[model samples]
Target: MANFPLNRRQLIGGMTAGALAPAVLRAHSRGSAGRAVVVGAGVFGVWTAKALMDAGLHVTLMDANGPANARASSAGESRMTRGAYGPDEIYTRMALASLSDWKALSVSAELPLFHAHGVLFFFHEEIDYFRQSLEVHHRLGLPTEELTPEQMAARYPMIDYDGVAVGLFEPEFGAIMARRSVQTLVAQMVLGGLDYRRGKASPLTMPRGPSPLGAVRLDDGSQIEGDIMVYALGPWMPQGFPDILDRKIVTSRQEVFFFAPPAGSDDFSPAKMPGWADFDAGGLHYGFPDLEARGAKICFDNHGPEVDPDTNPRQVTKEGLAEIIAYRDRRFPKLRGAPLLETRVCQYENSSNGDYLIDRHPGYTNVTMVGAGSGHGFKMGPEVGRLAARVALGEDLGEPRFTLATKGTTQARSVI
Candidate 1:
């Protein structure tokens, strides 16, 4: 039998136990000074809610499946985080700021969510993106080293660096336990006085006309008015606002595999190995060093075909499995036929241009909608939340790329 991950019951129980603080589930207190309602409790929504609440707003956070829902793109076990966004230093700077936030939140929660195991970038030839990334890293004074093929071969024997021109290694950048971290943040905030509701909410409507922000229409026929509303629903944006997001946001299936290392072998252990990204001749592949003896995590970054979050089947295709195995054989020679530990089928919310969409709704000034993670937005969530909150309060983000005007129906992924 495949080594299964935590069942639904176990995950929920563990989350509840981990969240030791009492949270108010009530919504729309008439006496509250300022009220804000945020939909979708994934990474974006959770963090925005936390930021709003921290700013002394009585915030109501509603999600259909709560934080880290299995169907959500942010529901994965781990996500890689680094400061290199090709030559784009905006994201690199944002990443540095977000990393500080991640560490701070983890410290506050008493959970080791951000693991700084370092990230290794692999290249088989002259890859412009890799070169540009290195330039940005060097310019920012971030710690990075160019490893010769021979050096990489000696340091990481597991990688098949054949025909590789060079490898760039960024020290102290690593992966975060996505689900646990999301759960921990929202959980801790809930314990610290965040009002979290396990319910679905819609933003296209309002109960009163004074402010277009209006009231959120709940699935249960209840209305909760808020001074501001934020929709960070990820893949569900198309479902809720088909007219607006059907063309702007695209959701695609992403498959991941974890292969157990050879028995008792320390080769792939976190202490010895670093997380790797292979932008090689064949394709783009990435994997993390074994953590907690959970084997190396591997996945392809290509945005798979578009998919619907609610209806698409969440299982890996046999062809997909074969393609992944081929990478294993070429990359980690020792783990070619290792036991398949667990499988996860997740999705990515892609904006047309692959940049995060963080703008107020075109029609409703009081409502802000965010989506298009483009498979790499997890690490930026901390900063995104604070930015979205700022936008709702009429603060200029100074980021033209995140505006809705840049988002379109045509898909061309340029952001790395």
Candidate 2:
């Protein structure tokens, strides 16, 4: 996940839970209903396919590398979940609703996927973001606490509050096991009779004007025709529609590191230390406590250099490792020389303005292009799927911000 500095203008500029309820019914019969073909089995695509299937449509989900693959953005150890978007209430609401669904999923799963460890935000000089988010949280009735530096230290003694001015703690917000959750959701959908295929799909032909597509070509030279099609290819969105999305949706490399805490110490556990984001010196540094015995995970929430997801080498740069190590030592004195246990390299498919692009292609009216996660998309998977399904079904659920018309050629991210 990527987080960037928000200026006053950026902070100023930048949903129903029942409507997103998952219908987990076994596929019995779809009498004359149309077939919906969804390409890319990432978080968004998987949920979109599920929503479409539940809408009484015969749905087919296709992916080249399978769900939660190593290269997929949705394939990660964990992701933070919080309803704080610095005044962006739409995302806040969606995240809140998504957390509800995630809790439900975890309750029914064999192993818990959602970890309710809570999340904290450390606000430094620029407190406008935190203040605005606090207002929204209060209005939404989210259980959040405004804590001073002294209170934060008293609450979380393991973390150093050197430059922190204040803190916002969200008790209900937490982390979700990324890879396992996505895989589990997809597997459950498959067990419920979702037509899943392992193959690469592309537009058979570039149809002119706003016309329905004929078929989507596969790597095996076969074509899958459907009444409606959805392309939620994440980083591959540019490759899928180079003429349009090549510049609109950019893919950037992101690095994450996990360090082993001290032995025989429970202070670094999720129960002792909640997931935290530091906004000191106008930078975003975030991490989670040791979860499921995985080392304390940390990542700098800034977009890295652009990279081709398919070809980029998934190696953490030496500078990145050193930087994270220094940050770890400064924030957690006990882990001054913690050994690195694991590392991951992922790509965030970002839109021009850090908002999602979910709308029908002008040329392919029946085909919906859903992507541009912009780093903070994982937690909104369920709602994104619900909105995508509604759009693919020809419903005019209007939201100007998410439309393709708002996308630009150059990136000027306003949403965090």
Candidate 3:
């Protein structure tokens, strides 16, 4: 793992040699053919479309509310890009691959989108998950450190680790600007001659023969045809294909809050504090340092009630705010009464068992349905998009965890 620096001018110099060349070569390969129509312009859809374009295909991207809109799950200030999966090595690898692409894109964009402040995990009782994760990290040669409670207290003295049993630090991981990165990818692709449109799209009809999906109907009574079609609709999966995904994937309401630190205090900034995750008995709470002075970001990981992404009000609740404030007060006494700077309400399109659903539509071989971010999918967007593109182009990833058949109807949430 490369510990990429956050300096805007040194972004390119921070990357490992030849880090960006493979992705660029893969994109411009002459292996894939025909036209591709992708629905949804979120991180997943955008990356999949980019992958298709790189594979030498004519690709058209459509979005209902534009890229990373307020309603989309990818719309947020920042998202953590860490490799801690509590023993799930597959996701850890996926996150690492995605991180490379993120770093490459970050340097190419106007601003360095990835902030390399590192990530800290504060564990509670039962250290089995942490131990197994440490083993995987060591085996993979990832730079990870096991810190004692005393070490954590010495390094991050601003936060009070009352009941924290141990800490795991990954110095190479940090945060990725969410909305900005997605929009940047879309713009870069569009500037490179990729077709991007703002419209609502749905399959014209279920494929009943060996022929591929003919076309998709748009909201304005228009239609877009393609030899390969991908539906990476984030939260809209259940609504778009209710008959198959209604029970397989679910949408949950999630609340995020940003608290303003004390004036003239750099204690909560990225330079001083790393992005941290607390595995307490109550629930998993994670947050980032004050990057771009947008306050300290915090959110609980427990999935909220199921919601309809289309009609659900994007508003934080009083109760949710109270809960986070209480946690903040306990963890960081200095921020006990910090003013609330901002709040965002989003949705998580979670698949059962917390794994992604990247597979071909059972009714149509030419169409691939990709989604089920399950809250932690944002950081894995680049790799997910690439896998979705491969599946759309008639190649199998051979990873059953991502196959539709492996997705249970009940939400077990085995993956973090």
| C-alpha RMSD of each candidate structure in angstroms | 8.8, 6.1, 5.7
Task: Tell how far residue 245 is off in model 2, in angstroms.
Answer: 0.6
Model 1: per-residue lDDT, tens digit, 1-416?
11223232331111221211111112224444477889998998888888778666788888899798998989977888887678777777666657767777667766578778888887887678888988987776777889999999998887778778888898857888899888898878878878888888753632243346568888799988877888999998877776567778989998899999998789888778888888876678888988767778889888898888988688888988899998888778889888989888999899987889888777776788877788988998877887787777656667799998888899888887
Task: Supply candidate 1's per-residue lDDT for 178.
Answer: 90
lDDT (10s digit) by residue, model 3, range 1-416: 45433332222122222322232235436453467899999999999999888777789999999999989999999999998887798888788778888988999999889999999998886577888889878866789999988999999887888898989999989999999999999999999988998899853444565455668887678899877789999999977786678789999999999999889989999999999999988889999999999999989988998998888788899999999999999998989899999999988999988999999888876788999999999999988888888778666667899898887788888888
TM per candidate comes to 0.89, 0.92, 0.91
Candidate 3 colliding pairs: 27-54
Clashing pairs in 1: none
Order of all candidates by lDDT, from best down to worst? 3, 2, 1
Clashing pairs in 2: none
Evaluate model 3: give its lDDT.
Answer: 0.85
The candidate 1 region of ten consecutive residues with least summed lDDT is: 16-25
Off by over 4 Å in 2: 1-30, 203-206
lDDT top scorer: 3
Question: Of models 1 and 2, which has the larger TM-score?
Answer: 2
Candidate 3, number of clashes? 1
